[model samples]
Target: MRTGGKLAWGFILLLGIVHWDFWLWSDRTLVFGFMPVGLFYQVCISIAAAIGWALVIKFAWPKDVERWADEGRDGGGEA
Candidate 1:
């Protein structure tokens, strides 16, 4: 994959890892306590992280992904 695509994928994976429910489980009590702090804060953080990573990939490595895709197409030519 191109650099940008790889970066974007990495960021997406990271977002998934960060927002995994396992981490949130520990804070569930706080989340359901009606304080609206723990869950809300985590949601905000996850959203911000996703947006930031997406922007980084969109701007930093777009060409790399395109090149990688082109290479794949060339290598997969039909017989």
Candidate 2:
């Protein structure tokens, strides 16, 4: 596995850990006086997920897939 693969796996594990709902935050505790603490935490998780996906796409996307796409675009013939 390459660096990207390791990063992807690490990010996945982080998400799994965040999804555990064992926090002691009370329901009455609100973030920004509107969103509940749990909701705020989930929102943060979502943002992290989006960023993680971007990183994975940039660094972890299969090189073979990119090569295949280029080959198809070039029609497998000399320029």
Candidate 3:
């Protein structure tokens, strides 16, 4: 795999590991006195995951898959 692919997979693995939030299990702090710290942290994680996936799509997208899709769009594939 290429460097970007490796980094994207590494980011995915990191997100998987971080999603457990075990370190926040005992925390009771609240943010803006409304959202719990853990909840806020998870929200941040969600945002990060969104941005990470966007980056993966932008930088690590599969050219072959895209080409196949384009072929179908251009009616170059078996009809």
The local distance difference test score of each candidate is 0.66, 0.78, 0.85
| Each prediction's RMSD to truth | 6.5, 4.6, 3.4
Instruction: Indicate the worst ten consecutive residues by lDDT in candidate 2.
Output: 19-28
Clashing pairs in 1: 2-64, 2-65, 4-61
Pairs that clash in candidate 3: none
What are the TM-scores, per candidate, against the unseen true structure?
0.41, 0.69, 0.77
Q: Rank order by lDDT, top first?
A: 3, 2, 1
Give stretches of model 3 more than 4 Å off. 69-79
Q: Which digits, one per residue and each the tens of the lDDT, describe model 2 over residues 1-79?
A: 6888779868967987877767735655789989888888888888988888887777777769767767648466677
Candidate 2 Cα outliers beyond 4 Å, as residue runs? 24-27, 66-79
Candidate 3 lowest-lDDT run of ten: 69-78
lDDT of 1 by residue, 1-79 (tens): 6676667677767776776556556564555567555577678767878786776757565566677766747455565
- By lDDT, is 1 or 2 better? 2
Total clashing pairs for each candidate: 3, 0, 0
| Full-model lDDT, candidate 2 | 0.78
